[model samples]
Target: MSINSVKGAAIVTGAAQGIGKAIAIRLAKDGYDMALNDVPGKEDLLHTLADEIISQGRKSTIIIADVTNEKSVVEMIKRTVSELGILRVMVANAGIALTIGTEFLDTRLEDFEKVLKVNLMGVFLCYREAARQMVQQGTWGRASSVNGKRESHRDEHLIFFKEKKNNHYRAAAEMKKYGITVNAYAPGYIDTPMARQALSVNENLSNEEIRQQIIQRGSSSSGLAVNLGTPEDIANFVSYLASEESKFMTGQAVSVNGGVFFG
Candidate 1:
């Protein structure tokens, strides 16, 4: 299925791979001209995905940017508008998971700062810039979506990460007057490249075993049994919030984790 009418341009950060890539492709399929952003080194992956988006008959632009840098993020948003006309949706999906296990206690201040800068401050920059443009456009269906993923058990950094997510609430309140709805998608145990990378660092377990562990963990918390989520699952929910149908909903984080978590 394809969305026939264009819904305006969407900027998705970290769109080169994993959940970010999936969201970009899904948004393109849903009839949004996409500005796909990632760090400078990931240009090839961004271009490949941009090609796929074009193949789907949607306009796609690859923007090499560092989300952690305020100037780069501001430019990224500016470029999107200059290239795609108007910005209606902003998906702040670029984030880094730096702490694993209980290593939060031993995590260096530098490491902690790096994660916060990329995951928290990055979202801040993207949201502010996007909102500024959306307000100037003075249009409906102006939306800001963010990603909230499952946290590893026993990770203290997860606490800070979750705290950052509360920005959606404040952003929603502030941007609603501008006709922009701010919401978040909290996903759990979805199979993505990031999950594989995290699991790969565990030399004790094979990939298959790690996969099953994830599935089992998800099944235990979810009403749906023995199933893991996909990146498209989160994207589909984002599609709704970005549309006119979900206009009444704001300041909420919708859980797309198959009943694993409630918000």
Candidate 2:
């Protein structure tokens, strides 16, 4: 179909609010159509969110799926292509935090399973389905994806790069088959309502003490002592990766942690 949308249609899971919402909005402003997703009942504002995009002359789709389900995840990509025509970007931003007070000794096995299922498994299913759809589209691709491609022994391994999180390696590999590129954004300590709630649980400490401790811990991990990051910081980073400017950059996590986790 030649990818008719002006920018592209992106599938962003967890786009109901917070960092996910910010990323969805940023991509829309850059001219991409949106397929925003959240677990059923977690979001009720898609009508309002979609209205904002139509106002700018773009289309929006809402998909409610438990991304951890293979069947449900597969259907999401299929419908996005069938409805939106092409799914150029897949942002697997849907995640849930581990229970705050659930210590290993006190935590139920079910809770641990719940966290991993929704997090790691959800990410995998979404990436797999998106890659499958990209392959069907028959787009052009780079050298690493061509027929009978191989890297020589002399090619740099750069072992340190293996541990990073932002680059969508699995998704990108599957994308390569379909001449598509997949990337991810791994943000740190973003200022979201969810985070605020987490931060408030330690009520014994005053706000100043808590802030100082947070800064101290962040400074240790990050090279700089910069304050907690805003969701917009992550939205900006997501925009660059989703655009053509990042064509050469794939399989990279590109930390936006104010120097907390460097490349």
Best by TM-score: 1
lDDT of 2 by residue, 91-116 (tens): 88877654333344665667656755
| Cα-based lDDT at residue 132, candidate 1 | 86
What C-alpha root-mean-square deviation, in Å, does candidate 1 show against the real structure? Answer: 3.4
lDDT of 2 at 50: 74
Candidate topping lDDT: 1
Assess candidate 1 and give its TM-score to the true structure: 0.86
lDDT of 1 by residue, 1-263 (tens): 45457778999998888788988888888889999998878988988999999999889888888888888988998999899878888988887764334255687888778877887888888888888888888886455555555554523355765766677678889998877888877776566766665544464555466657655544243344434578888778887877777788888776686665555
- Which portions of model 1 show Cα errors greater than 4 Å? 1-4, 147-158, 201-208, 214-226
Provide the overall lDDT of each model, using Cα atoms, as 2-decimal numbers: 0.76, 0.63
